[model samples]
Target: MNVLIVHAHHEPRSFNAAMKSLAADLLRGQGHEVVVSDLYAQGFNPVATANDFATRADAEYLVYALEQRHSHGQGTLAADIQVELDRIKWADLIIFNFPIYWFGMPAIMKGWIDRVFVSGYCYGGKRIYDRGGLKGKKAMLCISLGGQRHMFGPGAVHGELATLLQPIQRGMLAYVGLEVLPPFVAYHVPYISEAERRDYLEQYRQHLLGLHQLPALEFPSLDDFDDALRPRNAL
Candidate 1:
């Protein structure tokens, strides 16, 4: 399978980096074509602006989504965004490797999604969720957390892990039609021992190796909603 790992972390020696590296090596050893986007190392621009488009769709106002659709359709997208889009088009599986920051993804990773998953390319119109443009592709998040596992569970300080990731998994990945796999989260990496970190890496390797057999997270399909996007049974 063709795999793309979008790694977002500043420190090369960090546990997140280790997981990303381990994934690349292990996947390549298994004969899968792998590509890694080291966001911080590349100094990737996280902010989106009018600068993203060479030709303005609307010079008067900067409507980000409209501009994206226009530029994409005109083939005038910024070189950086075009390159990322090309990678997305080529991959069968895309993994987001990052450290969870403030209960969300790092800014760079979020910006990557904002720019690359534009209207004309990733999703628009009725093409969302299970019917989205990128349907048939797969996406998973491999994240590291400073908090312990217990802290993120029900009635704990952080609430449910699945709920915490719902915005990205359901709202973004699922919205774009990517089959969402259960995330591989390494909890309390900073407090863990070296052996535990190694064990986590090994576990990540097993996850990647078994990607094809893993069942996707359950999400509501378009068919489940009425014309107003409310659940059919609700009306």
Candidate 2:
């Protein structure tokens, strides 16, 4: 399986980067082709400039708060961009490894998602489940946090990690038709001792080696039991 590892952490020695390296090595060891997109190192154009679109040349997609996938079939990435898309096309699984800042992903990672996941590529919002583009692909996240595990639970300091990541799992990945897997998260990374860190590193290595063997992600629904069953007037 070909795997794409997009990492957003800036510091080379950061735990996030280390985890990225660990995942890459483990995947490669298993005889899978791996490509690491170190955004900072690559100096990727994070902004969605007008040039990205084949139709518009002077307007920015984000200005209109456009969230739909934009195709790069004719612009800067054009054919070159298709290469990365081809990688996604070729791969069985795609992994995003990064550190969450301000309760969200890094700008670069978000930008990559914005740029690469284009219309006719990632999703069209026509079919509800497993019917759009990227139907057979799989996606998972590997994230590190400075907060303690206890802090992420109910009535805790950090709230729930699942809650924080629900959109990515349900809305973003699954919304686009990719199977979303439960992520591998490492907590208290900033405070953990070196010995503990090394142990976690080893554990992470094992996870990467066995990631493909993990079970498939089941899609969820807006028919949440907690919310009222009646359809709302507003979309």
Candidate 3:
């Protein structure tokens, strides 16, 4: 399978960086075509602005999504965005490797999504959820956090990890039609011992090996909703 790993950590020596490297090496060793986009290393610009398009669809005003559709159609997207879009198009699976910040992804990572996942191509109108632009592709999150595992879940201080991640998994990945896989999270990375960190890597290796058999997270199918996008069975 073709895999693309979008790594967002700033520190090369960070645990998140190690995970990214391990994934690239291991996947390649398995004879899979792998591509790594180390955002920080590349000094990737995560900011979204009118500069993204070489030509404007409207000179007076900017509607970001509409502008994306126009630029994409005219083949005028910024070179950087086009590069990332090409990578996404080529991948059968995409792994987002990053460290959590404020119960969510880092700003750079979020900005990457904002700019890279174009409107007309990734999602538009009725082409969302199961019918989204990346329907056949798969996406998984490899996230690290300083919090302990016990801090999350039912009645825990941070609540459920699943709930915290719903925006990315359901709102973004699923919205774009990518099959969302359960995330692999490393807890208390900054505080963990070297042995524990090694264990996390080993466990991640096993997770990668079992990718073919890993079940995707449950998401609402377009078929379950009516024309207006309301649940078909809703009273």
Badly placed stretches (over 4 Å) of model 1 are: none
Q: What is candidate 2's local distance difference test score?
A: 0.72
Candidate 1 residue lDDT tens string, 1-235: 8999999999999999999989899889989999999999989998999999988889999999999999999999999999999999999999999999988999999999989998987998878999998999999999999999899888999899999999999999999999999899999998999999989988988887787789999998999987778888774
TM-score versus the correct structure, for each prediction: 0.97, 0.82, 0.98
Point out the worst 10-residue segment of candidate 3 by lDDT.
103-112
* Per-residue C-alpha lDDT of model 3 across residues 84-159, encoded as one tens digit per residue: 9999999999999999999888988899999999999999999999999999999999999999999999999999
The lDDT values for all models are: 0.92, 0.72, 0.95
Clash pairs, candidate 1, are: none
Candidate 2 clash pair list: none
What's the true lDDT of residue 140 in model 1?
Answer: 94
Better of 1 and 2 by lDDT: 1
Regions of model 2 farther than 4 Å from truth: 57-83, 221-235
RMSD vs true structure, all candidates: 1.1, 4.5, 0.8
